[model samples]
Target: MNRSEALSIVEPHLTKERFEHTVRVADTALTLAGLYGESQKKVEIASIFHDYAKYRPLDEMERWITTSYLPKDLLSYHHELWHGPVGSLLIDQEHGIKDEEIKSAVYCHTTGKANMSKLDMIVFVADYIEPGRDFPGLNEVRDMAEKDLLKTAWMVSRNTINYLIHKQTSIYPDTFHAYNDLTKQLYGGN
Candidate 1:
């Protein structure tokens, strides 16, 4: 779908602040797509729908996880992490967006998994580095983004883990997988 269509579909599902955040993420993802040679169309679609399920009720998200093929392990994690996986499924079910790349990008946007595609990295990093966000290590990740996408994603992964650990929340396994995979890709380690 086109940008306007995608935005319209997602806007009602999100809070006003989140809709604005989605727009920033779309703009940020497009910038990364331009730099990394990814398809701008895919980046835009993925970014627009990245938070499609963010405002879903906890019980509804839990039901989607249990009934759909989404990983059951998500139920054990904080409800905050459910949006990405639920959003991934809902986009296809509700909006007819069946693109696997877009689905995967949305699936792991919050806690990235191993073997991320260029499109996935674009959306993942774009969500984290979007201008409205303010995290401890955000500036450095934003700077690295223009220079190198992989390293920037790795930093985002690292920073996310660190922040979660500081808050003493349960860190999802896919998050660590993202960090480890990026580290291996960055430093040539197994």
Candidate 2:
């Protein structure tokens, strides 16, 4: 589906505030994609659907997990990271989005994984730095997004790890892998 059609499908599921945030993320992703020479269409689609499953009731998310046969690691990280994969499932089953890049972007937007695609990075960082987000260090991330996409992604991965650590939450292993992989790529395997 196209961007407008995808947005329509997700709009009813999100609160008005969240819908607005999605729009902001789409715009941000497009801008960042242009700067990074990534596919703007993929960035737009990924950003639009990044949070599609975020507003589902906790019980419904759990139900999806139970019935979808999602991996055990996902269940282990459910409290923190279930939404992304669940969102991917919802998009596929409900929205008929069969594109691998789109599905992968939605699947990994939360608790990013190793060897992320360009669209994945765009969606992940766009969600984090969207206009509605007001966290410390966001400015640095925004600047990095404008100047260097890989650098911005690496910073976001580090920030996510730090936040999880500070909260004393169990860090998802995929997040650590993502950080390591991106850091190595940005540093030329150093």
Candidate 3:
């Protein structure tokens, strides 16, 4: 579907602020796609739908988690990371987006997994560095994103882990795995 169609599907599922943020992320993902020579259509689709389940009722998200057969242990982590993976399933089943690449990019956007695709990196970093986002050290992350998307992805992965640790919250295993793989690539260690 086109941008408006995609947004229309998700618009009722998000708050006004989140809808605006989603649009910014889609725009940023398109920019990154242009910069990194990835598929703009896939990136845009994934970006717009990345948080499709973000505002779902907790019970609804839990039901999706179980029905989709995602790791039950996900329940233990903060709910902030649930939307990406759950939204993947929601978009595919409810919105007719079956392309595995787009689904995977949406799935990996929150707490990136190991072996992310170029499209995945674009959605992931765009979600983090979207112009509507503001956080400590955001400028540095945004700068890193502009310079190198993959390295910026690794930076976001590492930074997310640090943030979770600082908050004394559980860090998802996929996040640590991504951090290790990206670190090995960026720092040259096995």
Candidate 4:
């Protein structure tokens, strides 16, 4: 779908603040797509719908996780992480968006998994480094993004893990896998 059509579909599903955040993420993802040689259409659509299921009721998200092909382990983590995987499924079931690149980007946007594709890294890093967000060490991440995609993603994963550890919250295994995978790519193992 085109940008306008995609935005219209997602706007009603998001709060005002989140809609604005989604726009920022799309813009950022577009820039990264251009830099990283990814398909702008895929990146735009995935970024626009990244939060499609963000506001779904907790029970509904749980139902999607339990009934759909989504990983069951997500139920053990915070409800905050459910939206990405559920959004991936809903985009297909509800909107007929069957592109695996787009689906994978949306699915793993929140907690990235191991061996993330370039498109996945674009959406994932774009969401974190979007202008509206204000996290510690984010500027460094934003800076690194222009120079390197994989390293920037590793930084985002590292920062997320640190933040969750500081909050004493559960860390999703995929998140650690994202960090570890990127680490191995950037620094070859002995």
Candidate 5:
């Protein structure tokens, strides 16, 4: 599906606020993609579908996690994280979006993974720093996003890790992997 088509498909499932957030994320992703010389279409599609399943019922999300063969450990964490992987799967299985890059961007947008590409980083950072989002330290990341994609991505990843730790929430392993990978990219690889 194309951009408008994808937006219509997912928009019905989201609340008004979430739909607006998705639009902001898509806009932010397009900006980041332009800065990084990535594909605008891919980033737009990935950002649009990144939260396609955000409002899905928890039981339905659990079903998607179980039947889709997603890691069982996902359920051990907050169910809030389920939409990323499950939405990616649904966007592929149901919406006919087979691009692995788009799918991976949606999959890892929440708790990013190791070895993400430029599109993935753009989508992830865009979602976090989208204008609708206002959190402590976000201005720093947004400023960094303007100048350095890698630094912005790393800041967002580390921010998530630190927030979860402070909340005593179960930390997803992919978050750490993404943090470490981006750390090496920003500093020196070992």
Candidate 6:
């Protein structure tokens, strides 16, 4: 689907604030894609639909899982990370999005997986660096994005892992695996 059509599918599901954030992320992703030589169309589509399941109620998310064919381990992760995969399924089954890159980006946007595609990195970092996000250290990540997309993704993964540890939250193994993989890629396996 085109950008406008993709936006329409997600607009009805997201709150006004989230819709605006998605728009900003799409713009950011496109710019990043241009700089990093990734596919602009994939970046735009993935960014637009990244949070498609964000506003869905917990029960609804759970129900969607019941019908999903995702692995059992993924279903056990109850945090916001689960929304990425769930959103991907919703976009494919409900909205008829068939692009593998777009679906993969959405599926792995939250807790990134090892060896992520360029499109995945774009969407993931775009969401974190979107203008509307004002969390501490975001500016640093923003700068890192401009200077080095892979480095910024690595930093974001590290920060996310640290944050979850600080909160005493259950850490998804995929997140740790992603962080390690990126760290290895960036720091020559330390």
Task: Give lDDT tens digits, candidate 2, residues 1-190.
Answer: 6788979988999999989999999999898888778888778877899889898888898889888767766667646588888898888888788888988999988878899988888888898998889989999998888887778889999999998899898888889999999988978765
TM-score for each prediction? 0.98, 0.93, 0.96, 0.98, 0.97, 0.94
lDDT of 4 by residue, 27-114 (tens): 9999999999999999999999999999999999999999978889999999999999999999999999999999999999999999
Looking at model 2, residue 69 earns an lDDT score of 63
**Any runs in candidate 2 off by more than 4 Å, and if so which?**
188-190
List model 6 lDDT by residue over 54-164, tens digit each.
Answer: 988888887777776865576677657678988888888887888888999998888988999889899889988988899888899999999898999998899999889
- Global lDDT of each model? 0.95, 0.86, 0.89, 0.96, 0.93, 0.88
**Which tens-of-lDDT digit does each residue in 49-118 have in candidate 1?**
9999999999999999999999999999999999999999999999899999999999999999999999
Task: Return the lDDT, model 4, position 25.
Answer: 100
lDDT of 3 by residue, 18-94 (tens): 99999999999999999899988898899999999988888888888877777888888888878888888888889
Ranking by TM-score: 4, 1, 5, 3, 6, 2
Q: How many backbone clashes does candidate 3 have?
A: 0
TM-score of 3: 0.96
For lDDT, candidate 1 versus 3, the one ahead is 1
Q: Which has the higher TM-score value, candidate number 3 or candidate number 4?
A: 4
The lowest-lDDT stretch of 10 consecutive residues in candidate 3 is: 64-73
Candidate 4 — which pairs collide?
A: none
